[model samples]
Target: MRLLQKNKPVIRFLLTFFGSYLILAFLYNLYLNNASSQKYYPEFITHIVALQSQDLIEAFGYETKSIPSDYDPSMRIAVNGDYVVRIVEGCNAISVMVLFLAFILAFKKDWKSTLLYIFAGLVIIYALNILRIALLTIAIYEYPEYTDLLHTTLFPAFIYGVVFILWFIWIRNFRPKTSPKDV
Candidate 1:
């Protein structure tokens, strides 16, 4: 009892951090592992690529085939018969890192005040990822030469930058207050 009282704040902070981290990590990993292992994500990406390529070809009167394939996980653009476009599934690491940071920042010092902040940050991250994937796909198809720029530099920076801004706002405005006794 003495030990618990003496270290109450530290213990509370640690428990909150570990608990939130475990849950967030588990769910994130489970989603990625399940989505990647199953045919749903791959097929969905393939269909989107194929349909978009077909539309572009039809609109532009081009004769190129761009049937989607998992030949390269980074990025790839190909021609089939009457389609041309790029497909990409990169930036998984960037997204995970953003979420992890948000989890850490929102829960490390105080879990209660920042719970909603963390949730909003996570939702923003998820939505941004989908947009990133779509933008990269279109970029690859439109300008294959700029694939490296889109995949390696632009998208990662944009996504992570947004996460950092959100975290900063949370820390500035919503962080828990500590009394002198608590400190």
Candidate 2:
């Protein structure tokens, strides 16, 4: 009880922050899921994937095709004429949320650090996500057996690890110092 009382401000801040995020996420998901039969999410993800594909095709030596189907709600990318890559929208959201949380946790008490961290984090995440999609597209073309493992384990770990490293850098270089007396 005493500990809770002592940490009341911290607890309040956390509760308010998380509560607002959850409410907003829920509302957004609800709007995307129910507002239309097309499910704003899949198309939005497809657009992002298409843009990534265009960049990859321009930068790398790969060609991609878009197939329209009602079979699954995922972005499909074909590479080199034969291989197919299916990227689900949920996975993209998960990766993005991980990056967002990393920035939030890293810059919790400082607005300046928070703004810079968020901008850097978003750029990193966007670039990484494009690379991730491109790699997965290539992987599906080369090794089908490794697709599940890479998608389920390797990619998430790699991206999150990068975010963690960035958070550490932000803390070491940017976080404001507080004296013991302040605590």
lDDT of 2 by residue, 1-183 (tens): 989987765676577657656765776677557543354436565556555654675467777764534577765566767637666665464445544654465347677667767777777876777787777677767788897897888877777777777778766877667577535
State the RMSD for candidate 1.
6.1
Across 132-169, the per-residue lDDT of candidate 1 in tens digits comes to: 65565556667879978877899878877877787677
> If scored against the real structure, what TM-score would every candidate get?
0.56, 0.77
For all candidates in order, the CA lDDT equals: 0.57, 0.65
Per-candidate RMSD, Å: 6.1, 3.3
Cα-based lDDT at residue 76, candidate 2: 59
Q: Model 1: runs farther than 4 Å from truth?
A: 1-19, 31-39, 43-113, 180-183
lDDT of model 1 at position 121: 69
- Distance from true location, Cα of 96 in model 2, Å: 2.8
Number of the top TM-score candidate: 2
Whole-structure CA lDDT of model 1: 0.57
